[model samples]
Target chain A: MLEFILARGNYWVIVALMMTGLYISFSAQNLIKRLVGLSVFQTSVFLFYITLGKVAGGTAPILIGEDLAGHHGAGHEEDAAHGTAAAGHEAPVETPAAPHVETEPVVEVDPETGEPIADPTAIDPAAELAPDAVDPGHSDIPPLQGEDASLMGEPLEDGVTETSDYVLSGHDGAADALHQAAESSLHSVYSNPLPHVLILTAIVVGVATLAVGLALIVRIREAYGTIEADEVRNIDIDVALEEEEAEDAAAEGAA
Target chain B: MNPDHHVILRVVAKTLIPLITLYAFYVQFHGDYSPGGGFQAGVIFAVGIILYALIFGVSSALRLIPPSFTRGLAAAGVLLYAGVGIWALFGGGNYLEYGALLDEPEGGHHGQHIGIILIELGVLFGVAGSMLTIFYAFAGRVAEISDEDW
Candidate 1:
């Protein structure tokens, strides 16, 4: 149970932040303080959304030319230019040691020209890759977390799953390991960008709400001469009472 | 807001403002290739303006971008978006179907690119203007808060 909680610690943080923000928002009497609390709550929601989009062994979903191998994000063109950089390398280990790739091409023939295409199967790197060996990084990951399981159908090796930093780690495994690592990096999962894009709009809306709420608070303070909710209510009550007394006097005069 | 109030801040802002604006534009344009897009870029641009207002009072900032202009910017942005959608309709496609804008068989991708750029541009203008307008509305007010309030 502890391991499960630890694995998804980000959720805990989101919950904590949400509760704290809610507490402050509900309990605070001052209008500005309430706004601050609301902002905090909004921030927690943003964190929650962004967290949901994250994948354990993912990169940004930018397409590198015709590779469709790994997503290279905008402005990070260098990432696609330098292949296998997604391997999370400590040094400049290019192509996960390119010469060691032991590729068995799946052959196909073109229908129209009757020409042979050289190994189009190489384009789809993830079709044959599977967890034949224990993936050390994901061995402890809870099976309940369908996030990782759905991606590679197993815990991946360092080149794909282990490195958070955009890649290259030289594992001096045999040629088979090298081949697996190279192919895996290209097919590595990407964090879902849909949530990220949606959250951007959410953030803007949050700010707009904050701005409008704060502006209303300022107007309230100007009119009521206090920022405290109770004080404003008390002032309103006093004015209502005075009006009632005046009405009573007028009725008495008419009588 | 006085010129002598914070010399250091003024100098730093003078140096940083241009870069911030440039970065906002970069984020807006390169949003397709990266994490950022219209909404993110719009917020960044607004932050730059808000930063300026923070250092040099609301009135000073308002001089640079009048409230009317911001309002116009917001309206124009919305109109631009609607205009593009209408244009697509004229091209005999569904509402906002960018591919219909061009007559070419292979024009779908190019049309999509253009449509997305225009939409993003609209979003940028609308968000930036609305944010600035809200900021101005709040900051233009003269609130008297005593030190005891703290």
Candidate 2:
């Protein structure tokens, strides 16, 4: 439980921020104070999303073409070796160093043209070319491999580009430790793009709401002569009481 | 507001306003590549104008940008945004389908860029105009109430 809490400390901070903002928004008597609390609440929510999007050691999602090219070259050799091994080249199948990678799904190929179909399930070639490896500085580890090219209906070198490429692919025994590190970096650690995009729209909407709210407050102040919530409530209550009393008096006269 | 105001403040404000305006435009255009976009740029532009109004009376600011014009510009901005979507629909694509605007297949990417720029410009105009209008409405009433009344 301690480890779980420690691992998710960011969530705790988010909860604290949310609770503080909520408390202030509900309990604050001043209308402006309440608005401030609302803004604080919005800010906390933004922080929550941004925190959720953070990868442990991941860089910004933007890809550099030069880096991808470099990774692409390194990946090709590993892919070829894996292809040959899978084709019964008598190469050692198991690497002593690297953890065994479950064979990934092969790309479907059209038999007529001997070309790979654009499989949506395949990680984008661009994304595959991306140094998705967590430690970008350490280039010594080989690219992770996709299925052997021979396994697909077409030749690996001609049709398969991204799927066959992997870090430390053939040198399973030699690069096993690095492969595990890369594997850890590949899966659980990446940021989700959805929240980032969603929050962009949310922020604009939030600002629009804030602007309208402030405008309404200004109009309210002009009509009531005070912005205090207590004062405004009292004024409204007095007007309601006057209406009720007038209605009662009118009813009595009618009777 | 006075012609004989503190020389330093007047000079500093004069220097800063142009820079702020330039930065707002930069943010507007550079938004595609960077962190800022139409909403941010609009707010910055409004802030620059509001700062001017604070240093030099509201009347001076109003003279620069009349409230009537601001109101119209706000509506125009919204119309522009909607117009782009309509234009795309008329071009035989779904609403706001930027690719449909590309006459040539090779221009598909460029067409999307054009659509984004147009909408962002609309957002800029709407946000800046409305913000200024709101400021004008609020400031115009200051004469009726004295500071001590608060």
Candidate 3:
């Protein structure tokens, strides 16, 4: 989308404005007009920076966490602990446990009689329990907590649950999280010293240039009782001719 | 002052000059995330003020920003920039290396921010002062030489 905008109209406008400003700055004899042109030219660069920093669906690089509103957080010690735990081992506790008993019953119920009727296809209980029986009284296994119940709310077919569903369902919350992440990344990248340093240098150079330019203008105005460049130039030519004539007369007098 | 010129152009120029300068500071402070910094924004802001001087005459603008003060400001800005780097150097780090100043070998990123801000402020001062100086020089010349310098 940003590419489209730049390509379609913004790019041309920026270029045109920059060129126009440069042309005015160079061609115009008036100092004020030249400054105006320089400003226009500078504005184009500003627009370029703004355009380059643009990111689609990206928010301002501000950390909005409760602890640091609009500040980026550095790496924490807890992150290292988590990393160690993840790298150390594949703990059995991490896997979802199989259900102890089957939820579906084999018996068919008659709708009219409201009675359970034994089906001929029902397997013997002993045979069914031989291979898949799970002990319910295992002391080592802790009872399931709220975490287990929450996981259970998901589809039962797959022993493992899809975390994506939970995140996807929370559209606004997920977007906020993503936005925060993007913002922090932007902060990290933009917070570097290089650009700031460059800008500082540019400003100093710009100031010095402006100062020198102003000094020149002052000298010009003093030389001719007018700030106008054309008037100054004419005065300079007249002065030069007067000096030349004086030198010629002096040489002739010496001869 | 010509009331008509003051009414139309001066008012707008006055409002824009400060507004742009304030915006430049905002950009410098928030540069860690935004598309602005001390230098670029500072130049724009200084240019804005120069525009004000151009449109409303230098005397009016000089009332707000005196020439003598701006020269000091320019030097002060350079001092600020060098101060940060020197502080870092004194802290046992290489020049311009901000991490040493904080005594946190690992907090280099944080130091960079501090250093950047210092340098940016320096740039802002230099640009604003110099730009104003330019305006002053030209305007002063116009004042002294032109029949209608006022």
Better of 1 and 2 by TM-score: 2
TM-score of each predicted structure versus truth: 0.64, 0.66, 0.45
lDDT of 2 by residue, B24-140 (tens): 999999875577778888888988998888888788899998899889888888998888898877766667766555543632455567777888888888988888888887786
What is the per-residue lDDT of model 1 for residues A163-183, given as tens digits with 9 covering 90 to 100? 331122223334444454455
Number of the top-ranking candidate, with lDDT as the measure = 2
Give candidate 2's chain B TM-score. 0.90
**lDDT tens digits by residue: candidate 2, A87-114:** 1111111111111222221211111111
What CAPRI class is candidate 2? Answer: incorrect
Candidate 1 runs further than 4 Å off: A57-189, A248-255, B1-5, B54-57, B143-150
Instruction: Give Cα distance to truth, residue B39, candidate 1, Å.
Output: 2.5
Q: What overall lDDT, based on C-alpha atoms, would model 1 receive against the true structure?
A: 0.59
Ranking by lDDT: 2, 1, 3
The lDDT of each candidate is 0.59, 0.59, 0.50
Per-residue CA lDDT of model 3 for A14-117, tens digit only, reads 78889999999988878767776886787676554443333222222222233122111122223333232111111111211112211121111111111111
Give the poorly placed runs of model 2, Cα more than 4 Å off: A57-193, B143-147
True contacts kept of each: 0.18, 0.00, 0.23
| Candidate 3 clashes between residue pairs 3 or more apart in a chain or in different chains | A63-A70
